[model samples]
Target: MLYKLNLEHILFLDIETVPESETFEQLDDVKQELWEHKTQYQRKDEFTAEEFYERAGIWAEFGKIICISVGYFTSKGDVRNFRVTTFHGAEAKLLKEFKNLLNSHFSKPNHLLCAHNGKEFDFPYIARRMVIHGINLPYKLDLFGKKPWEVPHLDTMELWKFGDYKHYTSLKLMANVLGIPSPKEDIDGSMVRDVYYNNGDLDRIIKYCELDVITTAQVFLRLRNEELLSDNEIVRI
Candidate 1:
């Protein structure tokens, strides 16, 4: 089904996260206990909390966002382009900057933030982290008391679910299904932590994050049955 929302007002984004500490042993005593409790249902007798720490990035309380890449559609005359940018470095610092951008440009009611599996992952993770960082949530990200349909967010994976709560689809899977070019190679989600902490390569991670943003936009376009943007049309801003 074609989404009634206007394309120009949508902001597509993706993020990469890693364990808060380089290793689970680095967590303080209190946090260590919390991690064990938080992950018990998932790890249960198979692995200790420390052993499962690599996956901490999946939880906002134990993980932190290292990169947030965003893309938005802009038009010049008859040409439409998707311009991209990244906010990365210290998680709090980058989050504040991203919040500022939202407050300045994308806080309008007409603006909506979209991401793959965002409602369950990216959106809530960002909100929790912002609260921890003492940053106020931008109107678009804040959902307090908002009706279900009133929330200014779009989730591509959720759209594909068609009300099947048990369904799960990766961005790569969605891109391949939609005939959009995949942006994966070199590294996948599992290797992001090693690439960041061990390899010291935020640049590489940023590139990966940027490609996800592009793919997300492309996936959204496909949902609307619109033509994919030619490579020349994706401008990195």
Candidate 2:
């Protein structure tokens, strides 16, 4: 049934994020205190608040989206292809670009936004960041009283769970188990913050981000028991 869904209507996406500040010391005094309080339960005495601050990208309140990469499938006869694109730079600009894309191209009842673990992370993270930036929420990302079935957002990770919530599986692990090539082979999520803040490598991050979107679409195909994309099928835009 999943494979029967229209591939062109699904916008596959992934995002890369980093702490709002280059360092914890850069946060305002009040924010510093709040960060300490917010992370207390997780950090405990294991590490200082400042030391644990590196992980702030996991929290939308403490981080900003640096890149959002999106991909979609198109077919002509038996030839299938994917086009990947990215929005990067200042958070506001990136958010606006993505919002515009959604409003202009994907704002339809039948279209969907898909990602790996997106419902919990990517989807909500993008929505929250848009709210923070004062940008309009794309219709696809806004839950707003819609029943679960009406939601256009699809999560590959959630599909793989099959109602078993206790077990957690990363995208890389899922890809490995499913025989899909891992996208994060060059740079994993753990290194994103440093690469962005310390090394100032937006190009590298954007490439990695796009790869994630491509891999996510591939994984979704795998879950649907469909054929995986070949290298020639992936076209970066």
Candidate 3:
């Protein structure tokens, strides 16, 4: 089934998120209590709510998307280019822009959205945040009543699983195993919050997010047994 799909019809994406507040104390009393209750099972006496707050970005209700980098394939006359673009800044503003892109270009029924662990993380997180901001769901992100196979989304991690429901793999690990080039040395998801709040380095974070998008595309190609993308084929738009 994978071999039958056209790469041009797919949009590869990755997102970076940070806690709504710089610190747990910065949250209002009500939110503070809610956070504690929300994370009780995950915290389990190992870490306090404040200590676990850094990971709040993993939950859309407690986080805001800072950057969304997307790449799509374009080919003409045997020449192929992977065009990459990013939407960043205010959460609501960026999400609106992203929604426009989805509605305008990838709105077709044949189009698909792909990411690593997207179904579990990226896809639902974007939809939840959009709902919180009162933004209407885009065609691809809105999965209200669609059947399982009718969903126009792809997940590299799920493809790798191939029926091994208990198996899990990180993007970095999958990229390494697939021999896809990865430059994830600087900072990982764990440091994104600190880098954003403490360093105020949105540029660095955007680069990291864009790289993940590129790596995701490459990993998909590897899964399909296609040649990896060359540096010259990637265009940052």
lDDT of each: 0.91, 0.91, 0.95
lDDT of 3 by residue, 132-163 (tens): 99999998998889999889999999999999
Taking all chains together, the TM-score of candidate 2 against the true structure is 0.97
What TM-score would candidate 3 get against the native? 0.98
After superposing all C-alphas onto the true structure, candidate 2 shows an RMSD in angstroms of: 1.1
Best by lDDT: 3
Better of 2 and 3 by lDDT: 3
Runs of candidate 1 exceeding 4 Å displacement: 1-3
TM-score of each: 0.97, 0.97, 0.98
Candidate 2: where is the Cα deviation over 4 Å?
none
List clashing residue pairs in candidate 2. Answer: none
Q: Which ten residues in a row have the lowest lDDT in candidate 1?
A: 1-10
Q: After superposition, how far is residue 53 of candidate 1 from its true place, in Å?
A: 0.9
